[model samples]
Target: MKTILPFFPLNLVAFPGQELNLHVFEPRYKELVRDCVANESNFAIPSYVKNKIEYGTEMKLVNIAKEYSDGRFDIETKAINVLHVLNMQNPYKEKLYAAGDVEILTNVDNGDIILKEALFESLTELYKLVEIQKVPLNTDFRVFDIAHQIGLSKDAEYDLLQLREERQRQRFLLDHLKVILPQLRDIQKSKELIKMNGHFRHYDPLEF
Candidate 1:
């Protein structure tokens, strides 16, 4: 099914089940948020990359955290689905913000059980290396659900959003882990060395 959605172009990529809190101040976006809230509507956040808007995610407004006297708003939203841009309109129908007619993409979950377990372990190790503790994810959590929390770049996350199969995304994640683990370990080792530099280590006097 196709639909015309209120569009919010952002530099960040949002994944399904991901919660995003935003500060809405721009006049156009302020109107956008106000309208969505009043109508109980959903919006699309397209990833703006390299001067072009590409794939995006659909998010439902969860709540308005606060509303300022100047009409600015702070909102909390959760991504509901992914979308592929079919076409777009600027200042859609004389509204302040842009609008896009997008096709909702299919989200498939066909990951290999073994590969999924490995991905989970790798993510855990990565978080540990960075010294950040993540909450226990639900049993139904898919890899895509945590891709952003696991430290994928904006570009990488956007790329991942385009994948239609779970196994393909899993493979991409596995490869990313393989490349990132060593780099993270190297960083951790450097931090350790830096901390130890000032410590007193007994050294043997060389025969001069």
Candidate 2:
């Protein structure tokens, strides 16, 4: 479905099911926040990267955590869904914030079990290489839930955000993890090799 969403362009890519705590400091956005809160409505944060606002997430303002004496706000927002911008207006007519006609993107969760298994293995290894003790996946988790934490670049994250299928996102991340995990392991081995007085040492510590 289509929507006329208010735009708050941010440099970071936001994903569905992710909860972000944002500090609203800008005057234009402060006005936007106050309007959304007062009207019990929501706004959109278009991903602004490489000097473009192409796609973003529809944010549901969960709580107005605090309102300062100076009209600043500390708010909690959750990314509800991904949206693609069809048209944009800077300052949205008379208002100081932008607005746009956004197309709510389709997101399907019909992924293969085998692909999910592969993802679990690859992501677990990925976290291990970073010395992170816990993998975020615990039997039943989603790719969108941890896409931002897996060393993905801004462009890659944005690419993933545009993908409409769960399986597609899974495979994209799996391929990325597969390609990067070896490089990371090699870098780790180089570090270990340096520690070993420059002797060539090969080690396999990360389980697939």
Candidate 3:
């Protein structure tokens, strides 16, 4: 469905189900936050990449964490869904911040079981290689839950957001990890070799 929402253009991509805590300081966005809280409405975080706003994630205010004396406040939010911008309105009809008409993208989790399993294996290896102590997998684990830590570039993340199917996203991420694992292994080997540079080593003599 298509609807209009207050647009907060950010440099980072907001993944589905991601939690964000924002410090509302700018007058325009401050106004937006107040409006959202008052109306109990959700807002859009349009990814501002390449000096343009296109796709983003929809979010709802969880609470106003703190209110500073200078009209600035900290707010927590959870991403609800993905959004594709139809049009943008700066000032949003007299408000300082921008707003947009967006088409909400429903996430499809019809991923192949095998694909998920494979993806999970790759994810596990990736976590091990990166030394991430905690794996955030829940009952229904997904790529969005760990996208931020998997070495994806901003552009790659944007592309991931554009995909609606869970399986497609899984494949994309799996391929990404596959490409990275070899490089990581190579780097690890290089590190190991480098560490041996100034150390004494024992050699086994072969008997003829």
Best by lDDT: 2
Cα lDDT tens digits for candidate 3, 127-181: 7777778875543688788788788999899999999998898899988988999
Quote the positional error of residue 13 for candidate 1 in Å.
0.2
- lDDT: worst 10-residue window of model 1: 132-141
Q: State which candidate, 1 or 3, has the greater TM-score.
A: 3
lDDT per residue, candidate 2, 20-96, as tens digits? 99999999999999889888988999998767888899999999899999999999999999999999998899888
Candidate 2 stretches with Cα past 4 Å from truth are 198-208
Flag regions of model 1 displaced more than 4 Å: 133-140, 190-208
TM-score of each candidate structure, all chains considered together:
0.86, 0.91, 0.92
Per-residue lDDT of model 1, residues 90-152, tens digit only: 899989999989999987878888888888788778878988866555545687777877667
Q: Give me candidate 1's TM-score against the actual structure.
A: 0.86
Provide the lDDT at 147 for model 3: 85
lDDT (Cα atoms) of all candidates against the true structure = 0.88, 0.90, 0.89
Q: After superposition, how far is residue 179 of candidate 1 from its true place, in Å?
A: 0.5
Task: Report lDDT (Cα) of residue 95, candidate 3.
Answer: 90
Backbone clashes in candidate 1 total 0
